[model samples]
Target: MSAQDDVDDVGEFAALLRALKERTDRSYGSLARRLAMNTSTLHRYCAGEAVPVDFAPVERFAALCGATPEERLELHRRWLLAVAARRRPRTASAPEDEPDTAADPPPLPRRPWYRRRRVAVGLAAACALLATLASLSVLPDGRRPAADRAPTAGPLASGTTEAKAPDRSSPSPTPSDSPATEQPSASATPKKKPSPAPSARTTAPPRSGRKPAAVPLTWSANSQAWKLGCGHDYVIAKPPRQVPPPPAPQDAGTWAATQGAVHGGETLVELSVQGRSDTAVVLNALRVRVVGRTAPAPGNAYAMDQGCGGAVTPRSFDVNLDKDRPIAHAVAGSDTGVPIPAVRMPYRVSAEDPEVLLVTARTVTCDCLWYLELDWSSQGRRGTVRIDDAGHPFRTSGIKGLPQYTYDTLARQWTPDS
Candidate 1:
């Protein structure tokens, strides 16, 4: 009946609830809804901040916890005691017949006092009977109550007692007794989970086979310096490179171990030339633009082979450079928030060499220091050839090269090399 005595019970129930959630892989909110209890109420109970008011609420909770009926009833008994202790007076229990200040105020004298006399007698009889039953012994050995025993009947009744069935026509004894059954049909229809206002974070799972609507990309074609291409020529008919499995990041040291570039710049070019790589080929195009800024390079764009092999195949001369597509631009590099211990600097250029931008990005320390560098070169008669140190090559063979800046580490400054 006291908190100390109820501690074990409370802990047991909490553990059971946790086990249920784990078994079903349901969140507390979801389980609370299934239990027909307010989320906060269930949370409070689980936290031991407050005890459940009735066994029914706990019954559902136990069900969710996957507790057996026997376990549930035992838990219910303790739950009742804890709640009762909380509501109990600070002092010792009062005498059974003592006037309780917490009792409901008497009804207003709407009718004459004489007319209410029989009603008062009936109430007194009920109270007296309840008190007598309370005095009856609870057997140490559990057994069903005598079939003919009428608990509400006092000694005044004859030895032969008969139990009467509850009148079905009568309204339910308590709202808590019939919550699920009394719930409105509307409540039965799965309620659309309340969504957060636009700014609120979403925590719900996405529908099967569908993803959450993506946040609209803020960067658009108007912002892009070159047109992004579509159709067969632009289409990647075959994947050039296979994505390697990401190494397990067991610790900072493990993460740092994977810090180095997986492949060298030349290897990337080879992958692009052969179309044996996937994402690297697109990066190669950017490198071409970077390198082309300084000198004339052949305008011929190379298409990679179906497989990312050393073999290079030529595609029809596509006149247009596609730059309309959105690209994630990075500016700075550091490891401030990265789990790894290094920095990652990213740089981007529009479809041409002229529209270059720098991105500072964090590279989580893994097993490598993964550094990205950008450079350029010129092939006489061809045109400006820019190379992205991120291991991408771009060939602005026919297009006019844009002015670009090159970092001169010795000067500790950016120089107008283009």
Candidate 2:
């Protein structure tokens, strides 16, 4: 059957996988080869017959097909749902109106001959003891013996002897001296100590307190400067010819570090945050901290993507570094340049539901060294996570009227952008 037909049988996850695969216009064998998996397994995943154990394969497949970040996030959501569904137990359906026909219970097993004999012997001994007690008490008369009767509180008649009360102060009688019918003294009986009460720590649920140094939220931040249609650019002291062609998006961070590049004109910081556990984390705020400000660095700007058309605009916040105190303001719409009334704070994220914040800090006056602090709370624990460019503050400077260059596809060299 076709992938679409299989998707109809399975669910939305398979449908999305098939759609992404179809967009690439590649056969299962070719895609599977690139993904380093068996074609049949890939087919099963796309056809909804099976789900991948790990999301790594699914993400690699999406990247191979050039899925947008938003699409990748949606795919991750669907994958999480699929995983949950697979784990949930299914109960058998039954008609509530109909009464169940009870089956006959199995017969009890017979006791061993030796065990039955032992029980019979015990019963006989009990019967003999009861007969002996009756014979001793009756004395061939219908009345019970005087010793066997309960003592009366009234005074005794002239011919009758008075009963004496036992003295609690005296030592307990020996077992041989005590009457067979008498119970042991209360003092002689061993008292049981009450079981110790369970400890509060063991019985009660754990109390909420300050979490450890490691917060439950996991995050990564990347700083890049974009111009025109280019996603990331760098300002380096060396000329354009001295630098190699721009690296792929995944390698952009390392490439920038290697070239000793700094952000020019504007710096876009992308922060990806997700919870380490299944519990949801509330992102309280994203605050900016300016480390220092200096004059713009002297360098020529180089664009990563020269001829690429347009760029993907994610939900972003704008920060103007020229102000004494810069705050992140949420943008209303893509390319609208309208700031929302309030920042997008108090957002929820989880292992399954992640969040990405695009922060664009622009400056025309001074070079700024800045970093972000993300406040988050989860399960009653609140903390702040420092976001930076690989353990260092992100540096962005104004490039007003400085030399700017773009790679020319036709010339196979860097050419000045008009």
Candidate 3:
């Protein structure tokens, strides 16, 4: 079948799965064996004949196929849509010979003539009694009768004159002339009711001095350009010639993720931090925490960009990953010519005003698995937030002696980095 026919048959989610699998150039049996799944079941997933009960298997499959982060997100979105469609109920047509039971409602039971007449007479008498009571309760001017109104109290015994009862024959006093204790006229504007006090259950408690379980700060990581016009370097298993051309600036992360790349030598991570609420958060310090250390993975280093020009003077920091206890030191910008002062911590961030921290983590001795801990304080509460790649520690490796490659725009191919 044609590719278009297959897509129509299986669906968007399955089509994406098939495409990612094809890009890896591995047989279904080989990939399925690695995934620890039945080869036929894997084929069913790719063919759109079936969907996995959970996203875990799908995510694993995508990771094995080297699908980019962007592609994986898209895959997830399409999977949700497919799942919803599968669960949606389908309308079925009735058989032509079947009776149309719902076409007409069941007829109501009929009453005898004498019984119906008796019910009508009883309803009329009750309605008439209600009308008479309503007429007697309200006066012609919309005031209640004197007998129906609450009795007013006499004057208090402080040598004050006793209060006299209102004359029954006289019309009720206008709102302006009415006594303070009297009800206001119906035509007068109604008074607004005071709002009720909030209950303890509904009221939010004040922020305490105790630290919260989670920090209020939120951040995102992106691969940023380094000094001397060099962009991010990733170590991939593929040779220079076999790797694809350089990706655009915005697509750098997706490209790196798709190539199953690892940071080479140094990785410049741009951390965008902002408070989760309108309340400002103070960033006290950032500490590097190494999770694991091992020999650098063997692979060829590919630079995302080479020989590009331009410099950016942002709030930047430097960390030597080789140290047992690495500290992020505030650093001056490189290639900007002017001596820019390093921006020390104690930064403030809010929902509206965010802070960006450019960190250059370098390693020359060993491959490192590390993350950052940002100490922040806001509203009398202080806590530390763990920063990593999604939920995993960021990985970087030393590439001192590894072969390096860069894409050649003119040759339309990857060439050895000069």
TM-scores for candidates 1 onward, in order = 0.22, 0.48, 0.48
- Candidate RMSDs in order: 38.0, 35.0, 32.8
- lDDT at 9 for candidate 3? 32
Lowest summed lDDT window (length 10), candidate 3: 153-162
Kindly provide the TM-score of model 3 when superposed on the true structure, using C-alpha atoms: 0.48
Q: Per-residue alpha-carbon lDDT of model 2 for 1-418, expressed as tens digits? A: 2333323434888888989998887899898787656676678778776665345567778989889978877777676556434422122322578432221112222222111100000010111111000000101112223234221110000000001122235344333322231111101001211111100000111123322233455554435324321455567777777977775442344455456666666777656576656899898988887766766666787777634322113347898998899998887432224323333688888755555566888887766667677777777766655555432345667778679888776777888989
Q: Which tens-of-lDDT digit does each residue in 1-418 have in candidate 3?
A: 2334323533878989999998997999898777656676678779876565334467668989998878877776666555433322122433589542122111212222111100000010111110000001111223233234221110000100101122335444343322121111111001211111100000111133332133455555443334322356777777776678865443344455456566788867667576656899898988888766666656788876544433334447889999988899998763235455576779888755566566888998876767677777888876555555432345677888989887777888888877
- Candidate of highest TM-score: 2
Clashes of each: 66, 0, 0
Q: Kindly provide the TM-score of model 2 when superposed on the true structure, using C-alpha atoms.
A: 0.48
Model 3 backbone overlap count: 0
Clashing residue pairs in candidate 3 (N, C-alpha, C atoms within 3 angstroms): none
lDDT of 1 at 189: 10
Please rank every candidate by lDDT, starting with the best: 3, 2, 1
For residues 296-379, what per-residue lDDT tens digits would candidate 1 score against the true structure? 221111121111111111111121222322122322222212222111222222211112122211111110111122222112
Ten-residue region with minimum lDDT total, candidate 1? 153-162
